[model samples]
Target: MAKVLYIKANPKQASNTFLISDSFIKAYKEKNPADQITTLDLYREGIDFLRERDLGDMGDPEKLEDRNHRVFKYAYQFLEGDKYVIAAPFWNLSFPAILKAYIDYICISSLTFKYTEEGPVGLLAGRKAIYITTRGGNYSSEKTRALDQGEPYLKTILGFLGITDFTVLSADCLDVIGVDKDEILRAAIREAENLAQKF
Candidate 1:
């Protein structure tokens, strides 16, 4: 069975972002019952920002190869995943700081990537990722897409790790005036269900 890592960046269960997550997870579990799924709620996880001790081996690639290192736990877990499902809300044109902090912990040398004569090469090739996000003001539009750094930043990071097969399921115009939030959420839920079948 493939390992599915589901990362939740939002805390509120009632939030539109988490509503999408709830739907996705439910459908994914039903469709891929044999798959091994691991859920990591970042807010409940209390993931800390990288501290000095966490980066003690930042300069040493050899040290990173030691999977037993306390700081390497995140990297190792990330590497073990065959697929990833990340759920977050668009905040201030980006995602939550906790999610960014989690990213820093996973992007370690000798685990997710390594430097070569040419440049750094990602090790986790062929892995796939699905980004699920909700935006209050319709960041998906061309007029405002550039303003949304949350999804793009996450995609770039995952791509850098050689996980190029990516999909995005977003719920937009959540808080915008006159927008039908319920209709948007229903459509997103339907999309999530459809995507889970092939995921």
Candidate 2:
């Protein structure tokens, strides 16, 4: 059975993004009962930013530290998964710092990708990713797309890792004044459910 790795970046218990992701996972599980699912909650299982020592260990595999081992483990888990799902809320035009740290740990050279004679090429193939994000403001419009670093940045990074196939489910204008927050969230949840069936 194919493995699905679900990465949770939203720490808040009541976060709309988390709720949407949960709905998707539930539907996915129901549709694909034989599939294996794994979750990595960034807040619960903390990830640190790469430091000098971490970089040094990455350069020389022989001189591995405890933290480096954990980082490598994360990288290995990422490679093992056939599909991925990232659930995060847009924060300050981007995602949370913990999610960034998690990304840093997984984007290992020679593991996720490698530099070739022409340029950097992704190593992992035949994998796909689904990104679920909730934005406080409406950032999906042409006028505001440039300001949306969260979704665009994720797409770029995952593509760098050879995961070119992606499905983005975004719930925007969540915190906009006078907006029907409940209705927007319900619609997003329904969309998530529909996508899960074919994901």
Candidate 3:
């Protein structure tokens, strides 16, 4: 059975982004009922917060520390998964810091990746990811010129780990003026459901 890692980043329980994410989860579960799903709520459940020891542990795997143990355990769990889903709200034109920290924990040296004379090699393979998000402002218009730090960063990081296939479903202008959030969300759910069928 495939193991799925579901990361949720919305702090507000009632937030539209969270609801959309939950919808995606429901659809994913329906499609792949046998797949194991692990949900990580970064805001409420707490992520592996960065610390000096966590970095130090990467250099020497032989040494065991409390923070290092948590980092290793989290990395193992991440590597064990076959699929990953990141559901987060676009915050301040970017993704949340908690997600960033979680990435830091997984992408450690001699763990999820390796450095060679040629280049960096991803230890984890045969994995795919899906990004589900909602933004307050429309990033479609050139006049808005809004930068989407969420998708780009996620793509880069996952690509670094050799996850090549991923899809993004975004509902922009969620809180912006004159934008109908309910309509956008319904459309996003339809799109998500379609993706679920293929997934």
Per-candidate local distance difference test: 0.88, 0.89, 0.80
Task: Tell me the RMSD of model 3 versus the true structure.
Answer: 2.2
Model 2: per-residue Cα lDDT over 101-190, one tens digit each: 998988988888999999999887789999999998999899999998888888899999999998999999999999999999999999
Locate the minimum summed-lDDT window of 10 residues in model 1.
Answer: 53-62
- Model 1 has a clash total of 0
Q: Which candidate comes out best when scored by TM-score?
A: 2
Evaluated against the true structure, the overall lDDT of model 1 is 0.88
Q: Which candidate number has the best lDDT? A: 2
Ranking by TM-score: 2, 1, 3
In angstroms, the error of model 3 at 198 is 1.5
Expressed as tens digits, the lDDT of each residue in 50-103 for candidate 3 is 789767766775752333377676777788788888888888878888888888
The clash count for each model shown is 0, 0, 0
lDDT-superior candidate, 1 or 3: 1
lDDT score of model 2? 0.89
lDDT of 2 at 135: 92
Off by over 4 Å in 2: 63-68
